[model samples]
Target: MDQRAAIPVTLPRDNPTQSYWQLEPDEIADLRSTSSLPDKADTVIIGSGITGAAVAFNLLSNGARDVVMLEARQACSGATGRNGGHTKAASYRSFLGHQKDHGTAMAAKIARMELANIRAVHAFARDHGIKCDSTPCDTVDVVYEAAQWELDQKAVKAMQDAMPDDDAAKYTLHSREDVWEKFFCGRGGDESVCGGVSYEAGSLSAYQFGVGVLKLCLAKGLNLHTNTPALNLEKLEGGGWKVETPRGVITAGKVVLATNGYTASVWKRFQGVIVPLRGHVTAQRPGLDMPKEGLPGTYSFIYEGGYDYMIPRPKGSKFEGDIVIGGALAKAPADGLEEYGTTDDTAFNEVIMKSLDECLRKYFGDNWGADNSEGRIRKSWTGIMGFSPDGFPFVGEMPGEKDLWVSTSFQGHGMVLCWMCARALVTMMGDGDEKELDAWFPEIFKINEQRLRLTFRGRLS
Candidate 1:
């Protein structure tokens, strides 16, 4: 689809997350020595993370010219770069909802679309040569520790029955056998209940992915700036927009806001739709001795009381040594772990550590390797993600604004191609159908007049 002509917008800012992504020595050298600020453009993108990068990459490739990207900090400094790096086929939660609201077929379609997006992401990566160390594996969605096998069974059955025909051969329904046989476990499992759902997904060094996108855009003459934050936005006469910052002003016909968690306060209407929520994540330098069978499919980091996730990087490929176990401990009642995050690495102090520690005690009990094996806590930090009451992202134009659009708030799993989210938004902005795109996402984002009444009826915040 071709977009109408519009001036570009660019803001200059330095990259802020070179260390977090563990940039290769060479990439780091280039980034350190080659940073620049945003310049003038026809269209100004407000973020430099995954979604912004994707939109810019696609927009530029789609023939939009003179586009510039602006970031408050360095690229990938947001959730894009901070995620657990697992790209799976859609949301298990979304699938469950589909089965409930529309039935098995609709839920199947949702899963199929998600699975297809996984393949699309990989295919695009290959075609574009965007190397982010992406790894494809089947993930197992384990039930809550005390939950039953029936939970996993019932969940996977709905998924399997609703899955698209193209991916039918790519999955399997197994009892704990798949989890047990594929990845040996010393302890901490219940045999009688819900099993794991095995399906192929991908993982990558997330920061690298965003960095690569920025590099690609830079190569394409897309003027980008780091550190330059848009301080204000002025609606220009004749149907255009101009963004003001401490540095300068950028005039563009339209603005695309992809600021997920760190969404700016410059825009009044957007203030409500985008809610920034802080999430805590901890990564150890390198711990754990891998089993001979290799790492099990990485999936949702779930447990009894807290959520946890672990993945081995391609750097060692499980042959060398060192693994990182990361998950949510709890909010320090003192520090308010839920709203405001604990910057201290030891937030998992006694209180917060109980649940994960107990899970460890049950399975590895004094297990060496997981969390340093000697029960040592490594590094922990807070990253923010846009949150919503119902967990749906607002991916269309500002409800009543003209020529202004947004793609914000992904709660946790943005693995789904929220391309659908953006696609719907863009389509609606350009007078195209957004139903299919809207269907794949959470129900609350639909733009109809009664959408609110239907979605959150008595649940307004």
Candidate 2:
């Protein structure tokens, strides 16, 4: 059987594993602006995750009120809440492959755009005083395998040569001699296993971030309806869309599909192009006596056949600052494509669970969990991510669909780029041209016919 075969896409799964971020449900989790759905709205945003809330906020900020945001479940309950909570951007890790895939100029633009979004998020969190556990820190891309490390070095050099002034390229690549200190800092382990590169990055609780933005939007007259699934969308006779939900039908001048992995449920054309891949995540608290200050910054461990990302929880908690970790798709069955088009986050694979169980011990050594009292698994869950064939998000007016814009298929990097993408998209939604919003978006992210014609082989790397 072809593992890459497409599956019937739908809304988010009913019962998903709860993430640590949702440990304390937000006031807006299941909020509805009104007891019943409104009949009309100037703009309707489907999917109240990070992307949708961003669009709604920006649109309202730009004086476009009467915005309605609809969600299938609780607000930000999908990938946004289920994510690892890391907000770091791609420094030079994917620059080489992206350069090869989309050309040097476009790749540089993508890298720069990602970094800019990181800054934008930090600024938003600071300016709004959003207590989303926003942590502005550096990220270390620790490479353990010899081959990948060498490739990373070459990629960084190439990126520097191409865009010398690129801030993303302004990272310190540590060698074996200093890699251990740079990575562990006398915490994870003392052994000099491999090397890594460190650069500016940030982390935060995405659920809180989204809720904060949604709260502001609601204050500005944004109507949000939770547990309201957008069952169908029909083009109105004159100039709008009639969105059908279980609650009621609502007409809107414009609709933005920020649905991400569940996009195909509302937009059928994204069937093969936007695949929903299920990923597993784990949150573990340190033992009663484990050192809390050891793991300071966010980390991405790149090994020979697998990779895992981890972000530490904030200090002073009953759980004693658990570590949220995910990724290692390489260890998944059938080259990981077996999960290519799955919209199911209700079940998690045992194989991936076992891999995640042993990741910290393998990378950080025995210090992570020497005994039962030291390392305790707290919560484990699964989330779905939208994967685009071209490995870039579709962030513009849906091709051939008037007034229907989409900001989906972020390929699991939504936290790092969705804010800026939404900001630029709202501008595009206005009378502004691509040139005016060029600084906030990459050219390849734009939805066009040529991209729509390409064969999608479930390539998410």
TM-score of each: 0.77, 0.94
Q: In model 2, which residue pairs have backbone atoms overlapping below 3 Å?
A: 287-374
Off by over 4 Å in 2: 1-5, 185-192, 287-292, 316-320, 372-375
- Could you give me the TM-score of model 1 versus the true structure? 0.77
Clashes of 2: 1
Q: How much is 407 displaced in model 2, in angstroms?
A: 0.8
Q: Quick one: best lDDT, which candidate? A: 2
- Give the residue spans of candidate 1 off by over 4 A: 1-20, 23-40, 102-106, 146-148, 164-171, 186-194, 285-289, 304-306, 315-321, 329-337, 340-378, 418-461
* Residue 142 in candidate 1, Cα distance off native in Å: 3.1
| Per-structure clash totals for the candidates | 27, 1
Q: Each model's C-alpha lDDT?
A: 0.55, 0.81
